[model samples]
Target: MKRRATALATLLLTGAGLGMLTVPAEAAPAAPTRTTAVCPTGWGSTQKTGTSAATASLVNIRTGRHDCFDRMVFHVPGVGSSKIGYRVGYVSRLYQDGSGNHIPVAGGAVLEVRVAAPGYDPDTGKATYAGKVNKPLPGVNLTGYRTFKDTRFAGSFEGDTQIGIGVRARLPFRVLQLPDRLVVDVAHTWGTAR
Candidate 1:
């Protein structure tokens, strides 16, 4: 029994001497090897514009969330194969069209979205969106939105419509033109959109 005890002690001392049985005083946290490069960074905050002669009327506005960005969709009813044009850019301040009245948008940065379409029926002259100016968009519940702070109807005048988007900051954004809708996506963060 004494011999076995001695052998065990020798083994332990050897292992310790060889630096193979050492324990750290405090365990260090393992570093994460994962990356968030999946988020896109090409979309800039500069003014993005598309040119088209399509004449549509803005009918609705919608919002959705993604892993990397928050999106806003504008519904414009146009004729067959008609393309919508728009000018999306970050502005120092948003203003109401025709009246030049200052519009208050809640966020670190504001976006002035000018769509080449009116927000009312040209024939009937009836308002289609029906959303009031300087108020949160109707039916758009931004309860848990990460980037979106507020949205308001700037105004529609002279066959042109304007909308204001309030984001967390002046981050990268992209614009998309579809057959009858326009899309705008704002990234949540600079590097990792999560």
Candidate 2:
């Protein structure tokens, strides 16, 4: 009887009225909060270039928006990994490769993305990436992108394909060469650089 009473007393003492029942700090539920996306460091805004020959044709273009960056990809279907090369740099204006025509793009800054490959099949003499040159890339809707404002196919000539990317501002970016894929990522802001 005494043990039962002592147990009852202990339970009551740890109840709501006594304010003794508690959860460990680490076990407590986290309060809801907003946070910015984290990003890697060390990427810069300087011009980046690599040497490559037209071993394969550029076949497609793709783009995506992430919390920290915006990505653009060039697809060269027949090329091996790291076979694709690029020259990415900020330019005052974007110009066509063959015609030298000035192509106006939206945004505060323009990045000239050059892939060292043709956008046409050499043997068949057929266009691989059928999108019109010097036109805003068809079907690319940058309506809600944090950094990208516009994208255009500058031109493709002499074993090179040029893309013009209009970004909100001059921001850091990085390039990745994968099998048949040349990926470029532009940070949403300076804080998200690299």
Candidate 3:
């Protein structure tokens, strides 16, 4: 009986040792690797001119956010395939549409956008955009944006319309004229300048 008990103890010790030496069938997965791409620099001085007059009228304005930049879009109807010319740049101040009064904007820098389109309906002689045509226009929300601070309708006169954009700083920007819209994208930084 004593010998049998000693043998049983030896067998239990061997089993425990073998269990410790055994390897797991599967190992935990490695932590995921993260990577981010570098964005381009030197986005500056964008301009485009259309061959024909703009047939559409400016009706609305909107803004959007991107990983590298913030965008503002000028909504126009009936633009279709026609060309629309524009000039956009940083300016000293923004002026009101018809009164020519200096309008105050909230930002470290200002951008002046001039579009070769009308903000009024030619047939009815009414403002195409239902929003306020002056400073403090309604529905231009600039929340949680990195570059844009504020935007205002500067004026619309003689088949041309203007807008003022307030930015965090004098950053790089580009302009795009789409089939029915004009888009302005302001970079978050000037390459390594940020």
Candidate 4:
């Protein structure tokens, strides 16, 4: 009986050692990448390039103009402390067909406004903005992907991704309240941006 007990204890210890050896090591996550998108800022389907780098984009649902406006007056809902910037131009006038030439907008529309913070890419999904010296994004009211009608589009400023976060409606009207102000619409993309 004594011999059997000693053998059993040795076997148990060996089994425990083998189990630990079989454990797999944790894998490290991939590094984040930078990206951007386009916005008309109260314009009508006018996408301007070379704007500020944004990780996401928002468009009005009712209209396909990539925003809930026809001119630049919409404010960035929660970007009060974000130090937002802008640039004025007419992107709607420059159109293109399959030939890649500057054509005209179908309804003779011209997006006259200042674009601030270019749009975002939706491929990467999200980013980790809370670590080390890089803190998370501020409390901007801009919804993630909920405001737009595109189900395939991921919305809002989620981390450092290129997802759009604004109203995606294509309307022929413009915001009159602040024609020169770009109000960040917290409810721009509805609940989709979150």
lDDT of 1: 0.86
Off by over 4 Å in 2: 1-30, 192-194
lDDT values, one for every candidate: 0.86, 0.85, 0.78, 0.33
Estimate, for each residue in 41-83, the C-alpha lDDT of model 2 and write its tens digit: 6789999998784378888888898878999888898777656
Q: Which ten residues in a row have the lowest lDDT in candidate 3?
A: 45-54
Alpha-carbon RMSD, each predicted model:
4.4, 6.2, 5.4, 19.4
Residue-level lDDT for 103 in candidate 4: 31
* The 10-residue segment with the lowest total lDDT in model 4: 128-137
Candidate order, TM-score descending: 2, 1, 3, 4
Off by more than 4 A, model 4: 1-77, 90-92, 95-103, 106-109, 112-114, 121-194
Total clashes for model 1: 0
Q: What is the lDDT of candidate 4?
A: 0.33
